[model samples]
Target: MHIVVCIKQVPDSAQIRVHPVTNTIMRQGVPAIVNPYDLFALEEALRLKDKFGGKVTMLCMGPPQAEDALKKCISFGADDAVLVTDRSFAGADTLATSYALAAAIRQIGKEQKVDIVFTGKQTIDGDTAQVGPGIAKRLGLQLLTYVSRIADLDLEKDTITVERRAEGGVQVLQTAVPCLITMLEGTNEMRFAPLENMIHAARYPVRKWNKEAAGIEDVTKIGLKGSPTVVSKVFGPTPRAEKALMQSVEDATPRDVSLNVIQKIFTQHPTLERDILAKASV
Candidate 1:
């Protein structure tokens, strides 16, 4: 079984800055980290590999510096790492990203047969939750999203069973191999890397691929040109002027404090007091 995990290197949200003039995210001087959600997917894939005794490949689409993210996955037990970085892939939206990633997966299939593909529920930067289904559609694979647990895998039968999160309850789903799964966060914890694996990951020669190498043939379907959505501006929510009022009852008795709060509520909203009295009569 060959499992492919797609990951992204994103700016640390805590350290991210917005360009004052352009109203864009300023990635310069911001520390980069693997999308936290993607780590859950990687950990689940690694667990599968541990049980099935097959190879797990980590794939990413980002700048050259994203190689570090791939190396981190290697330390967590990924068998191979591939970085697909190119100027042509800059400013890609979810649609274009899926196109490029599906193309790269095709290229990887030529080298090894891929039985499953895993991705995060969503990225912190782009929380659209569209890429996984888009990649599945493009690749003609089964699509499963918000998976909480992988219950079973039948290698001989080429089928997988998983528990998917739904509106009210969990959905137990069975699907064929070569499916795409977007793992939900908090499903599994990432494992610690061994000392030897950490050393190996630091020295690992990660494969780097450009647009051509990643098997993207059409120039019109990648990068800024391929993206349909345009961001006019990015800004944080405005802070409200009036702060919330706090009630202090440190020295007062509980009953007195409760009565004080009730009186204040009635004073603030006379209609609320009348409505409460009317309801109490029932």
Candidate 2:
């Protein structure tokens, strides 16, 4: 079982700031961390590799600085890491990003037959949730998104079963090998790296491929040219002027305080009483 896990290095959203004049993200001072959702995919891939005794390759398409994120994956027991970086890949949207990734995966498949590809449901910076499906379309791979659990794998039969998180409940679906899976968040916990693996990861030389080296032949199919969507503006949510009113019940009993709080809420939102009554009647 050869598994490829796609990951991204994203700015820590908690530290992100919006520029006052340009209304753009101020990434200058923000720290870069691996996307949290991708961690779940990586952990799931690692678990499969551990059980199957196969290789797990970490792949990422980002700037040169993104190699740091791939190194983190190496520390977690991934057998190899590949970083696809080039200036032409700048300002790429989901379509171009998926195209480049699919080409690179084809290159990786040349060296070792790839059985599965794993990705996060979405990237925090983009949050479009289109890249995984795009890659599947480009590669003609069966796509399973929002996967909550990998139930079974039959390497001998070349099939896999997974529990997908759907609206209201879970869906159990089976698919063949050479498929793409977008893991759901909170599906699994990331494992801690051992001291030996950490030391090796610190010294590991990750493979870096340029646009041409990664098998991108069409110049127009990558980078800003291939990206049709453009971000016209980025703005933060406006701050509300009024603050919430604090209700104190130091002298009242718990029951009285609860009633008072409920009354206050109903008074603030006049429709709440009617809404509650409607639900109760139903």
Candidate 3:
């Protein structure tokens, strides 16, 4: 029942700023923090470890600074932490990232049989929601996304049931071991690290793996060369020149205000009323 939880260190989006001239993200003064969504995944994994009494490993692929993020997970009670960092893995998109991470997971599997892999539903910076599924496809593991809860687990039978949040309701699905799950945010809260754990995390020797160590043989399959998606440009939304028109309800009755709003809408968009009537007739 060994669980591997993947996390990423990302810039605090609240403090992120865009360059005025280049329109690129200004990361110079921004503080880095663990991806919020990944915290839920970590907490869920920790919960399972508390119940099942198995090891939980934290994995991340980023620059050397990302080791801090792994240490943070260690303080939260993960048994081990692995940092896969190499210059060759720089500028990787979701595809290349998944390839590197999948390769690294294969290497980790050699040391210990990984029963389950957990990740966040999406990264805040990218928000593509593709890496988890990509890793699952690359590793041929069962894919579960938007998981709200772990309903049941039977170690003897190698079966696990989970509650997945779907469009309208939750779907309870069971799958075998060696599966990948992308946990939905707000499903669980991260626990506070005890003083001993914090001290241990600070002194823990985080295992560092480069591309060669992470089992990446093909140089072309990682980093920028493997990334197919290209951003043509990045720009902020155009600012509106006119301010919104304000309706004063202080001097008007509710009925009068309602009529005034509808009248204004029709007045501004002359064809809106006609279009509504036309659609209603159909």
Candidate 4:
């Protein structure tokens, strides 16, 4: 049960402040934390590792500072950590990101066969649950997203069974080993870091790989150069033109307020009264 958990370092939600002029997130001076959702994924992977008695590896793709995220996972009981960082990977969309991560996983797979890859449901910044699918597609690994519960894990048969969340209800799906799983948030709480794990994580020498080091020969497919969609601009949602106005009670009572509001609506637009009465009969 060599489980690999893919975690991400993200700006803390409390310190997330977008630059008004540049239309970009102000990451500078913002404290970073393990992506909230990824915590659940890591916890699940750790649980599996504990049950099956195998190693758990944590992988991340971000700036060098992202090593902190991996270290945090180590404190939670991951065996090893890998950091995939390259300037060429900047501005990468979900597709490009998946490509890079999958390549890194392949490199690590040569040493020890990775039985499973775990990820969160989605990222807070992107919120697009596409990277996991993209990674699975590239690696030819079975993808199971939005897993709410793990019904069973069979080491002998090399198979895993889980309860996945679908549009309407849960879908029980089974897949072979070497699959990718995206964990649903709130499924399991992260365990507290014990002293042993904390000591190891602090001194853990996380392996670092650049684009070429990860065996990404296709330079075109490595960064924003490979991304199909371009974000010309990102801004907050447009504000509404006007807010709803409340009607005060002239007679100082709930009944009076209701009556006054109705009268005001009718007086402002008499035709609205007829339409309301016609629909009220239904």
lDDT of 3 by residue, 211-269 (tens): 99999979898998889988777678876899777678888888998998999999999
Candidate 3: stretches off by over 4 Å: 239-266, 270-282
Per residue, candidate 1 scores C-alpha lDDT tens digits across 1-282 of 899999999888988878776667777898889999999999999999889888999999999999999999999899999999999999999989999999999999999999999999999988889999999999999999999999999999999999999999999999999899999999999999999999999999999999999999898999899899887776766657998656667878888889988999999999999999999999
The reply for model 2, stretches above 4 Å from the true place, is 20-22, 237-282
lDDT of all the models against the reference? 0.94, 0.93, 0.93, 0.89
User: How many backbone collisions does model 4 have?
Assistant: 0
lDDT of 2 by residue, 111-147 (tens): 9999999999898988988999999999999999999
- The clash count of every prediction, one per candidate, is 0, 0, 0, 0
TM-scores for candidates 1 onward, in order: 0.86, 0.86, 0.87, 0.86
Question: Distance (Å) between predicted and true CA of 91, model 1?
Answer: 0.8
* Candidate 1 Cα lDDT to native: 0.94
> Whose TM-score is greatest here?
3
| Candidate 2 lDDT | 0.93
Cα lDDT tens digits, model 4, 144-231, are 9999998898988988899999999999999998799999999999999999889999999999999877889788987898798899
Q: Candidate 3 at 93: error in angstroms?
A: 1.0
